[model samples]
Target: MHQVIASPQGDKFIIARPGTRKGMQIPRAMHHELSSAVANGRDVPGWLVNAGREAWGLELSGQPARGNVLVRPVTPLNYSRATWEINKGCNFNCEHCYLAERAFEGLPRDEKDRLLSMLRDAGVLWLQFTGGEPTIDRDFPHSYRQAFILGMLVEILTNGSRLHRPEIIELLSAMPPHKVTVSLYGASPESFDSLTRKPGAFKLLTKGLKAAKEANVPLELALIVTKHNAHEVQAMREIADEYATTYTEYANISPTYDGNPQPLAAQAPGFLDKSSVFKGCPAGHTFFHVDPHGFATMCKVGRENPIGLMTEGLDGLLRLPAIADAQMLRSGGCSGCQLSATCRVCRPLAKAYQEAKAPLNTYCQHDNGDETA
Candidate 1:
């Protein structure tokens, strides 16, 4: 595996490690030189060796550019980021899961290889592998290694259940991810097991966390606060602090991606923080999401007008920007809302809430006398 990935992102050129955030912005001239050297099968440049040493403490001197450093080719597509749901499967049954049904299903190995290539061709420099729990998938190791081989910075969104497995740890240790984000259900075993509906969930999670930390895997914790574990928020923070890992809190729960309202029952009433104002996002334009079977959507939430990568391929993505625009328009219950100017929910998310017949107070700001929110 290449120690570093050198790729072009729009007008910028960056050299970054596969596992860590450490990177350096190189000038156009330097980028061109590196690209030419890789294309021509030349040795690593002296300047890059010195620079890598300075930036990431890497020793690249006397190494061949062909295998030691991966130089990604520029592509016609302008997309920079993407998220692929490896499979909608999980070991734990969290009540607050956004996926209504966790099914263990995805494309075959060859089809997945094709999809990753298409993503690379689409200029996706950063790729996130997510799932109901990505690590549980049998093809995860192959997919992860393939993404890294293609010179894309890979990030894993997992529950950390399988991190303790010897093969999983060994694979991660060999080809480090840009980051491994683990969701913390609860701090204590009782609360954690209860929330997940799995008796030994907490013990397994703790074991995985320790193993991943010992293996020096880059990790970030997502503290998923629900009614069942809201009381343990401080203890959760303490656990994160104990590991000296960065963490973010997720208190507000949403309905399932397919507009199912079951997950909303688990929302901690006191912890439902107001969402940030919905500024315009570059979902389909700069970034997109793909489901397990390779159907690409504008984002994870807006599952409308999916383009099946298995049949349609990269050309199908050309329609995404327009699809995204159509989906973002204020429609249905949100049409002509006076409060849309200040509303926090985007049109697609608002539509999901509408489909679920969620309480207006949960997502809408319109009062009873207003225009039928």
Candidate 2:
């Protein structure tokens, strides 16, 4: 319930409000002083009070830092960011969804509490709750509130179908998220409903979007361009502009996370943007992903050697970095490939394409007869 969070993000000390994008980097001395004041149940230092007021317009003049500002403790774990799939149960059936199956199931409430605590103990400062659609999850409100209570900045990735619900709007208004990223299927009701294979889907999404906008909830729109809705891209951008919300267009569709090629059929021709050259990433080393059941993976695209958080707890994560390294090895069909240096796909993603037996031209430069490394 603290108004702001003060935490160590890697080597940097930052003070950030939960709902706002603005954050201030403070000196280590200032962080320590604030921590001391909060621990001792003393008033917030005058400088922080002034800084909060100036940076976020917060009125924390004489408030106890203990209740006004949460000082997140540095943990043994080095992770600073994570994404959790609250549940894979989405209300819409998008053809290009990456999950092979949309199972509407997750850990019970008690286990979810344990998992969130473990995430907090693991040093996760920024947590994104995604799903097949996170808004519809029965425990979403509780889990979202719990994450806030645990002093983690929370974001949500949704389809914007349920944002209009009174309880949801109320929960979000009361405890604002760092962001709510909604995926826009199409601009028109006919196109959107047809693409999602759900009648009236567009009406629900627009309703949710308007409600969220009116609530002043932070929002970002992802315009998902596929074969069914590729023609509506301009209109979708107009919608985003209408709301004055930040937007990004995603046209490159990939196979399901489990290597099913069904989603590839939805890829819009001439709209599949070429990915940039594969560079190294800090998946398990810095940030990781979690499934609804608390199984931690290196990232969403690479699901190998998942560590069961429900069983092994935080110690299970110790194995992730090594596992991530092994998964990144250029083995299998990619072994001895000279073009890997300039290849657009990473090892795990390449492995997925290989598993799906997809056409080489979709992911490999070698398929185009380019031998340069």
Candidate 3:
């Protein structure tokens, strides 16, 4: 007979020729079974046994559980802006690229298609497509159309390089992504290229922005505070007011920038991370970061590592060994912050953490005689 055996952790099942120990290990969602067991007196083994009966064509003695355990209960927030990296490689040579190692060219077409289905299955109703520059990908337009058909509200983050082309502009204006956020590196070529380290990038972005404005598409601007553009703060703010909604600012906290000499903190851009939303670590209550290579962690930057890609889906990811570690770190990162009440969760910070090693070497340098603003 074909059947499976459960582990004490309730995360894995060994599928064997009934009763054999040597079986293919499979990931199991523990929410309902574990919850039911805890609800019915911690008889986890019994609960799983019953769960197996139903999964493997056996008769359950009582009512069966419905729905996946890993999925959080549905609510209005399900569609609230989920971010996805559409492409990994970047065009610019910034001094502080956190994902410098992982950042490569675009994902394969088939990989993109698979990821779309995966996101949809994960209850992702809205997608914020970020990249080195999403506009650089040739399939981005088609990707946009596909996401739209899946009932997703799509957003894009681009350097605005390819957007100057009429074809790109026309599609964006016609369909209109839910939002388009552009990174305005500098006020002019001299200022922009100084930071991006790529001559002509500033001009390319400006051309793209102007076309976007002419296309009648809503455009927003972002700026990262770096040694190259700190003095442009006021100018950036004024420029933001010119045509964009708000200036979404970030600091110089990429992997390459950590532990390095930088301008004063007062010279850095103002920003917030999610921890500002709660009193302490919000690991369990709040969301966690899913790294580009696929690992789940507590605060994205902390040392805890609970789970990993044990299978083909996220169901397996939630059950990894590092989750608890991440959770503890998540709790600690939030619980002890001196400015917890005033702080906010910053994805870029988490992005840096997930993409680089800790002591993070960048923002966490609270000890340096140089904790600028």
- Please report the candidate that would top TM-score against the real structure: 2
Candidate 3 lDDT, 3-45, residue by residue in tens: 2222212223333222111324445454435445435544334
| Worst-scoring 10-residue span by lDDT in model 1 | 364-373
TM-score ranking from best candidate downward: 2, 1, 3
- Per-residue lDDT for 1-373 in model 1, tens only? 6888788888888898888888998887888898888889888899999988998899988888888888777777768999999999999998888886789999999899999999999989899999888988889999998998898999889878888999999998888888898889899988898889898998898998899989999889999998889899999999887653599998877898789998888888767666777888888999999999999999999999899988988889999999999999988888877777777778888888889988876666444535465
| Residue 6 in candidate 1, Cα distance off native in Å | 1.2
Tens digit per residue, CA lDDT, model 2, 266-366: 87777756668879889999999999999999999999999999999899999999999999998878888777777777788888878888777655644
Model 1: residue 138 alpha-carbon error in angstroms: 1.2
**TM-score, predicted candidate 3 vs. hidden true structure:** 0.60
Evaluated at residue 220, the lDDT of candidate 2 is 93
Local accuracy by lDDT, each model: 0.87, 0.88, 0.52
Ranked by TM-score, the better of candidates 2 and 3 is 2
Q: Please identify which of the two predictions, 2 or 3, would achieve the higher lDDT against the true structure.
A: 2
**Model 1 vs truth, CA RMSD:** 1.9
Please provide TM-scores, in order, for all candidate models, with all chains considered together.
Answer: 0.95, 0.96, 0.60
How high a TM-score does candidate 2 get?
0.96
Candidate 1 lDDT for residue 60: 87
Q: Compared to the true structure, candidate 1 yields what TM-score?
A: 0.95
